[model samples]
Target: MVKSVSNITPFTLLDYPDKSACILWYAGCNMRCLYCYNPEIVFGKGKFTFSEMISFLETRRGLLDAVVFSGGECLIHKDIIEQIRLVKAMGFLVKVDTNGSKPDVLQSLIEQKLLDYVALDFKSTRESFLSITQTDLYDQFEQSVQLLFKTNIPFEIRTTYHSELLAKEEVKDMIDYLKFNEYTGTYYIQHFKNNVETIGKLPNSHTRLENHLPVNTAVKIVLR
Candidate 1:
């Protein structure tokens, strides 16, 4: 379960696939990625009680088609299953955004059929994964990846184009990582926007994906 949620952005179109949804920002993260934009939740700057969150969701029952539980690592909280169950009982398709840290929790949710979609962040090549997440997370990430691959549920792998951690060549390594594992879901190469107030630095502008790889070529590899 989640320790608590700190914020709710109602009626988000971009979070859940093809459905109107509410976004729940869970508090606390195990990793300390310097590039994290939601530091308020990550650092526990503010918190919201579960009762208040449930009340809000209850108010919008028919208006929304889904609920997206984003984090600060949502799966870290032991109460995650309970929360997902509650949301599912309310008849909302649930989507989870995770960093692939808690495979056990993820697996349990999958077994209980709690999620409709999962968006997992694949941060960097294995060699630099620790540096990127600022944690010794290889084993946990490996387990999470395995669990996702084992499941037939629809999912996506996302990468933020961080010049400090990834490059043209490194993206190729990332491609190889996915191909080797036979990950057959959608892969999104998201443009990294620098929020200087929160994250404090911009990635090198010269290293945009379009500059390094042609559009068609990048998509072909990314969608692999």
Candidate 2:
């Protein structure tokens, strides 16, 4: 029922906070964001099966503290819950990186106590969701954001920034919405890194320049 794992980073201190962990990159995505960095993962075929992933994890059991299920939309896999359960049984904390499109799946996992941490992507404001993420699932993302707030689950919500894709003013609107909804956590504004593998390119003038965000809101914005 699972798809495939595109790649694996055997160890990383940066991926998981306060814990050493391995990162498993899953193949395919539900959204086609213009500034997506992992286009190959989103568009290409995967190399390893779920069994292979388990075998690798088995080798690293005593060394790493956690396993990060990153994507190309990791939650889209039908067998993710079962996979997470197995990983949790293996004595490793499990973290999932997602676009927040599958809130139902996220809720189910959180309720079952299968996840340790979640990093959800918040693409853009409600009005610009479609144009920014190139998907019709804005409402789902909003619901997922709200759902996480009510849960006892530890999580972080972030948005990748590119001046052309999401303007500072538009991001302010999104922040306002988050404040109105009482989103109590920090909102990350990650600078876009452009390269040949980028799914969609920005205008020539804006390509590698980080969006200089101003301080004007109640919500915390972390730059990455």
Candidate 3:
């Protein structure tokens, strides 16, 4: 079969909350986020085939509790549904990290009960969505969010905050959007790590996030 996974993180306790997991870093992404840290994964080609990945996972059957399908965008893969089914059949819980551009694929996974958890990237407010992600799929992202809301699966909505790309007001708008949609989950604003090379040249964020955060909002906003 054709290769699709660029690399594999043998183990991680951080990526998947409360579960010991391994990360499959798939190659390529639909969006060109300026602050994307995985420039290599986004622009590189896969080094491992599905068979290779499964063989690797087979060894960790009992050691690992879950598998994190992270990418460039895991849902963009044509055979993602089947691939996920194979993993799920191995008695391993599955989690997907996505940009929320492929709601149709997300919906399919939800309907098939393939996903145990999800980490959705809420790039920015609708007005600056295109400027940030370089994609005009805010509607699709919103659709994905709504789909998750109707499901019983656990999920978290997070944003990679960069002082240059997004303002405190935009973050408030996103919080407002989530509140308006009746989302009662934690909204994470992760500060962009400046140590790594990004897709675009970005300077280190000097602004203190705590000072700019909205006060006493209904949605639980956490800075990571």
Candidate 4:
């Protein structure tokens, strides 16, 4: 059974693709990224019932085009397939936002044709991956990238650009790494936004502001 999560936003135009969709924010992430903005969900502070989410979705049946399962990490729950099926049964597209550490589960979902789109977050280069994510899943991340590259599913690779953690050169290195692995997908560079969670961890000075792009850049890779 999937763990019941909290804070269900029934309608959003930004979370999903071109169409409007609902987001199901799952609670509790396995990795610990220091700059995590959603510390409530990551630290297990949010709570919501699945039945409540279902009721909300039922009210917006024809209004929403997709159901985005975002989280602490949706794949962490074993009942992800069932949740996807339920969303699909409602005649809504399913999009999963994951970190791509659980390749086996992700591959099973793709093979079963359960997800239409996936957004995988790549924290940093393989060398600093463990330091950033606080996990020894460098090999798992590589495996997941390869699986997504071979799959028919459309997916995107994204990384949050926080000056404290990664430099501009390292961002380019990440893009080069993905290109080397034959991953022809959209790569989005999201900038770190300051909030309560990142108040103390971020830099106080603006000395390195000119080191990289000020805003995030989502570059689409054309796989040859």
* Best TM-score among the predictions, by candidate number: 3
Model 1 sits at a Cα RMSD from the real structure of 2.8
lDDT of 1 at 164: 67
lDDT of 2 by residue, 1-224 (tens): 34488998999998777999999899999999988888999997778889999999999989999999998998998888998999999999999999999989988998899988888898988777899788899989877887888887778888887777776778777777778877767788777765545777675326432344446767877777
Q: Candidate 3 lDDT, tens digit per residue, 50-69?
A: 89999999999999999999
Candidate 1 yields a Cα-based lDDT of 0.80
Clashing pairs in 2: none
Q: Tell me which of candidates 1 and 3 scores higher on TM-score.
A: 3
Which is better, 1 or 3, measured by lDDT?
Answer: 3
Please report, as a residue range, the 10-residue window in candidate 4 with the lowest summed lDDT.
205-214
TM-score of model number 1: 0.89
Give stretches of model 1 more than 4 Å off.
1-3, 199-205, 214-224
Count the clashes in each prediction: 4, 0, 0, 3
Enumerate residue pairs that collide in model 3.
none
Estimate the TM-score for candidate 4: 0.87
Instruction: Please provide TM-scores, in order, for all candidate models, with all chains considered together.
Output: 0.89, 0.91, 0.97, 0.87
Better of 1 and 4 by TM-score: 1
Q: After superposition, how far is residue 71 of candidate 1 from its true place, in Å?
A: 1.4
Candidate ranking under TM-score, highest first, comes to: 3, 2, 1, 4
Global lDDT of model 4: 0.77
lDDT of prediction 3: 0.92
